[model samples]
Target chain A: MIDVQHLTKRYGRVTAVDDVSFRVEKGEILGFLGPNGAGKTTTMRVLTGYMPPTEGRALVAGHDILEAPLEAKRRTGYLPETPPLYPEMTVRDYLMFVATINGLASAERRRRVETAMERTRVADMASRHCGKLSKGYRQRVGLAQAILHNPDVLILDEPTAGLDPKQIHETRDLIKSLGGDHTVILSTHILPEVAQTCSRVVIINKGRVVAIDTPENLTARLRGAETMFVQVDSAGADATPVIAAVPGVTGVTIAARRDEQASYEVASERGHDIRRQLAAAIVTQGWGLLELRPLRMSLEEIFLQLTTEENAGGAEVPRA
Target chain B: MRNVLAIARRELRSSFASPVAYVAVGLFALVFGYFFYATLVFFAERSLQATQFGMGGPMNVNQMMIRPLMLNVSVIVLFFLPMLTMRAFAEEKRSGTFELLLTRPLTDWQIVTGKFLGAMAMYSLMLLVSLVSILLLFLLGNPEWRQVATSYLGLLLMGGCFVALGLFFSSLTRSQLVAGVLTFSALLLLWVINWTADSAGPVMRAVVQALSITDHFDDFSRGVVDTRHLVYYLSFIGFGLFLTARAIDSERWKG
Candidate 1:
């Protein structure tokens, strides 16, 4: 478990993390979504006990990060933005060294290091020097190092940043698997990663926490207009007019068309659910209602909306 | 202690993995070997001359040969020991491994002391080179072995002071070159402080001479382990390590 209360970090004249507070329950994967220079790394640094916060405090596994930093650090694993690999050390030796410093028993170190290497999928390059590893491998090796000791908490900054699409997928799966065993706080600018892997999302911008919620709720909460996708088999006839005839239908546009089947994106009132009405109307008009589904706003759109609103307002704005 | 040893091992391994160790030890051995042979030949000639003239009995080997040899070694170490510690903290900071280290469960003292030991290990290898020449002196001639041992202890203590000072400088910057230059400048200043003492006021002269890093070694090489000199070298080392810890601690607040 991890708890951060009123955390603030400043570097001279610039405040990197401003009065941000959040809690991560045991076995939960919290996605930290933020743009570059948004204090994501700074917050992670504070949580990992790499540095003390300028104000407030953080607790990891029930230990305060500042007052009992060693205890907190002992229970937490950190993957900095840079991988922190020694160029001269072989990957195995590097992980072994990390294991030692993390306070693993001598007997546990070898097994843990091997397991970490295998889990991060860097086993094949075990003997290669870290300096010779590719960017993706370097990031994986960094991850391997973080989880090597099997710490209770893992703070990963941009864990999937340098990986290719396939590697990203594998990493996300690995992180998802790590959930329910290790509390994870991973920061990234990638929106889909949060939507796909995280149980909850924290959107941070300009040193402030803009929004925090589940990806689904974040998308649904920001949805002002209810939109639906309707595919109608019109049999050579246009079905747009008939759909428009339905009450509460504010607008309709053909999203795509293929031969006798066409899909229309229909917008209705914010609180309206016109699926039943639209489906019945199409059926009564002797048209086949093939498919109907609601389209929630994507996390990408919601993130942009929240961050831009926070930037434009630059003051506390009421949120529902 | 295990934590300290682990970090120390990493430092030593990294130094050996790079060309720095080879280059440093190579240059030190070359210079020290030259010093050894020159001192040996000079002492051998003087001893032969004294015996040939029947001016006195055999020249005292410890005074005439081994003491000067150890003195020259301490001077050569001043030139080379900085290379061993120049990268101790600076390289870790530059490579972002400082994050890895500071975030670990180890305390700042453990990290600092570990690095100190690592540099000392490298320094010991250079000292070992000088030892080989001293051993060759024993194999071929007679010298006070106890005096040689004390001289080595002196060199070890003096090297510890240099190493700790270099670590403090390295902690202040992310540039190895800057660390090396600052350490050399500081060591050189202390090395010559005794020479500068002659021009100072009488009261100031004693303090300046006592402060010279080399001045303490004179007693050790002469086969004396004066606790006064012991306290000075130790306090010098302790102060350097203490400052390094403070520098590392202040980084958190600044960040």
Candidate 2:
């Protein structure tokens, strides 16, 4: 539903978004993951028709963002980083104004505003002024404004930035519930949010896209070897050599030791399962196998690895 | 047109929601009331003096009271209209609602015109309060209602020019204070442009005097509805709004 082709935005001497290209399919929740100043917000701004890209083009529902901005903007809903709220207006009035501008008729505007407020769980604060609401309520009101018209595409920048943990979780759930109906592109520096809510993830850094894939796929693609953590109760027996000698075990290192129990992190050849063989070996060596678990790489590790590795590369690198 | 009206309605609502609108209108009414009273008292004194000299028949209240009162209203708008227009775009930019407005399906022209009309509505409201003060004159004296009506038309036109100029300046900055100050300065410059006509040659003098907004307003205050003055005020409004539209368009590129 959204296509961005080689979109480049520059601010005089500095390029904010450098030849960025990405596509968001209908009903797909794409997580835009990046560190600070990673051109995430800039890309969102361009896609929303809030600003024209310095180069390239973007389309929303087949409408060119620059050439047919009104049509493009009509099909897209944007929640900027700051929420774009009039503090003096009540929540209901703000949503009604958004609904009106989004081209809803009076009856539909009323129906949609109520539904939106209900969906965002902001119904109780409908009459309350936005300025008097807390940060969490304000964020919810912002979300309500974005989804009020039920546009085909939703562009949210840091939707869960300032909320507390509970509010973040609720927001993530709300976003997840929005999937399969509204195509969403939400940017955030939070890694777990992508894992929990986003179907696919785009990791950008320094004005360039470094990686784009599912969270699980990204972790799996970046995994170098199969790693397993094993805790064995051995009576002072040197278990490292024996464990390393097992078939398909490339390396073994003791990670922790507590009395007779020693934990080892074992690395096996790619696609190899050495747990059974290692357990048999430990039993034969008169050591009790207390625990055994595979160490799957987490999204946080993959994110840090990709972003920091690119930063360490000393130049712009497009991994996609 | 619907979009424009929607935006205008919201802007008008927001203006009233803030204290700025009330303070601006109240300050305008108070200052304008004082000026109207002072002018009325001065006109009464001059009329009494004229009657003592057997010149009462020659003393026109329209010229003595309504004309100067319209001029004073113009000056009052020059000072206070910026307060109404300063937050039109500057506050939106400051609070980040500019993004919301632009991301909607509305055109730049719609947004600019809506905001201009919204500010003009507030200006009209301020003028309405002063009108109530003027109506008091009709109750106590036999003032020429037609002349009063023409002077009001002049005030409205001049106020429209002020609002357009203020909107343009507001679009140029994110600081409301800067927008207010710049608008006041720009209006002051236009108001005093005719002052330099005295030192210029004949051709240059006409050009400078023509650019003076007050010079165009003079015809309306005199009950002379010249098409030339109407065209000038309309063109002035169009130019200011055109510049404001261009300013907002440039922001899209700069963003």
Candidate 3:
């Protein structure tokens, strides 16, 4: 429901968002992953109609963000990096005010506020002033504000930036549930959050989109070979040769060892399934197999690899 | 219009939630009360002399009392009313609510008008306190209610001008203190712009005198609803609000 075409934003001498283009389908959760100051917020700002792009444009729900801002804004909900909360207003009143400004009918405003609060799990703090709320509550209230209008597109910047592990988990679940009905585009520097919640990841670096694909594709494509970690209690006897002698094993290297236990990272041929062969080899050698698990390349490693590789190999510096 | 009212209501509600509204209104009422007492004493002394010596007929309380009292209020409006509008846009920017406001479906005109309405409401509260002193006059003597009403209209229009100008400065910066200072300076310049007329050339004199904000307010306080002054004040308010809208639009580009 969102189409961005070569959107570029510049602040005088500095280009915050370069010529970047991406499209998000209806009900898809697109994760915008980038390091801090990597122009994620700037890109989101242009998309949400908060600021117009210096060059090119974006369309939200078929309305050009620059030409038909009101229509576009009406269908999109935005939660900025810092949750916009009036510290003096209670959560209920604040949500009500947001509903009114967003042009919700008077008859429907109250119900929408309650539903939004319930969905974000901030209903208990309805009467409490936002200033007194904890960081986690403030963030949830912000989330509630975005969904209160029942907008088609939700733009959240660092939605889970500050929170306990449990709160983060709850927030991720909430965002995951928000999909299918709302096309969500969330930006974060946290790799796991993107991998866990977003259906598609857009890895950005230095104000440019270096990679965009599904989480599975990003990790699997970067691996190039199937690797496994095997730990064996060989009684201090080396098991590298035994693992290396397995039929599909191409290479074996000892990762760690202590006393009678040892760990080896075994590289296997592509499209190979050698778990049974490696197990038989270890058992026949009288080595006790402690642990054997496939080690897929994680999103973190892929993110690092993609972002770091962008400016390498004589990539030119961008100028305004 | 609904969106405008909603934003206006929030602006007024937030002002009262903080101490800014109370302190400004309280200071205004205190100064107004002191002026009312002094002017009443002066009128009482003049009436005593008229009756004792049989010098003339009874005094017109509205002319003698309420007129100068409102003039004093118009002067103080230059000082206190700017505070009402100083945080209209500055605080929103400082607290990051500006993003929420801009991204909403509402137009810049709606937000600016809402802020103006909220600040005018606060200005109205300040004017309402003068009612306490005006109502007391009815307890003992009859004041011309028409004159009283006209004086209020005068103060309202004058304060509206200040409120609009203050909103313009507030939208230009993210600092309330800076907004307040700039508003005060601008009002003071407009106040004294006429002062230069006395020594200026003939053409310069008429322009400066007509451009002075206080000169437009003089007709309203004397119970004269001159359309010229009405148009001037209305246009002044409209232009200030127009500039404020442009400021926000430009801010979006700057960001």
Candidate 4:
């Protein structure tokens, strides 16, 4: 478990991470979402014992990060934005060095090194120098180093920033596999990735956490009314007013148009299955209901709404 | 202690893994050999250096044998110590690995001590290799073994102090070249001040000579281990290390 209370970091007149506080339960994978230049990195650094917070206390695994730094650090693994690699050392050697610093026994160290390499799928390139590897492979090696000690808490900042699509998928799978055993806190601005991989998400904007909850819950909370996206065979017919005229339809907007087809997103009053109603209404109108599905809120929309609402100082009214 | 050793071992390995280690040792050997040979020829011409005035003047055989050797060693170190220490923290910062290191279980002091010791170990190895010349000198001409040992000891201690300073300077910058130049310049200024104090007046020279590294080394060059001089050198090294740790801690706070 990680507990941070009233955490703050100030640089001269500017505050980087300002009076922020959050907690991570054991075996929970918490996604830290924020825009660029936000205090995500600073907050992670403080929790990892890289720096002390100016005005707050952090407890990681029952040990204070400031008062018992070593104990706190011993149980944590960190991967910064850039993979902190010694260019001259090979991937194998780097992991070994990290293992030694993590206080692994010799026999256990060797085993852990191999295991980390295997887990991150960098075993094939174990003998390659880290300096010569591609950015994607370097990220993998960084992940390997972070997991080398089997740390109870893992803090990764922008872990998949420079990876190819295939590598990103594999890295997500790796982080997901670590969820049940290690408390993982990963910070990234890529919202969809968080929706796909994280069990709980924490949205931070301007050095403060604006929202924290399960991804589903956050999306659900942000949605004020039921919404559905319906595609029909229009053949040059306008579907916006027809969709709005459906029973329980509160609002209608033309989302897109293609050859012989038009798609409309319809919002209905609360406690309404607008999908079935819209499909029935389209069918009765002699329009072929091509596709009708509930309008699920994407992580990007939730992120922008929450951050903007926090800045505006108004109660965030989750609107569909 | 284990963590310290782990960092030390990695640092030493990195030193040798790069070309800097070889270049430093190779240049040191080349320069030291040139000086030793030139001094031997000069000694033969001057009838084995019958007399040479030190700071107090009127030196003995051991002083004559050891003073020249230590002076040459010190001069060589003025050029080489920076190479050993310039990359201590500067390279880590430049490569963005300093943050990686700080997040580990090791404390700031441990990291500083580890890097310092790593540089010292490499330097001592070079000195050990250079000592082959001392053995060769003994074989060729019967030099005083006691004076030679004391002079080497003094060189080692002085080298340690310079390493500390270089490490501290390295922590202050991200550019290794800048760190290297600054370290060399700092040592050269000390040497210049030491010599200038000799030709100048009493009061100002007293202060200058007190700060001179050569002054503390004179007794060791003459086979006398003054506890005061040893204490001074040790304290200088300690002060440098302390500042290095504090500098690293301060960066974390500000970063």
**lDDT tens string, model 2, A169-275?**
88999999898999999999888899989999999988999988998888777776888989999987769999999999877888889888899988888788888
- Kindly provide the TM-score of model 2 when superposed on the true structure, using C-alpha atoms: 0.96
| Consecutive 10-residue window with the lowest summed lDDT within model 3 chain B | B54-63
For model 4, what is the alpha-carbon lDDT of residue A257?
94
- Cα lDDT tens digits, model 4, A152-269, are 9999999999999999999999999998999999999988889888989888888888888999988777777777878899778998888888889888878889988988878787
The model with the greatest lDDT is: 1
A8-123: candidate 3 lDDT, tens digit per residue: 99999899989999999999999999888999999999998889999988999999999999999999999999999999999999999999999999999999999999989999
What local lDDT does model 2 show for residue B245? 98
Candidate 4 DockQ, CA atoms: 0.76
Rank order (by lDDT, best first)? 1, 3, 2, 4
TM-score of each: 0.92, 0.96, 0.94, 0.94
Quote the lDDT for B109 in model 1: 99
- Name the top TM-score candidate: 2
**Candidate 2 lDDT by residue in tens digits, B1-255:** 888888888888888898888898899989998999999899989988888988757878788888888887778788888888999999999999999999999999999999988888888788888889878988988888887777778888888899899999999999999999999999999999999999999999999999999888887777888898889999999999999999999988887
In candidate 4 chain A, what residue range of length 10 has the lowest lDDT sum? A310-319
Candidate 2 clash pair list: none
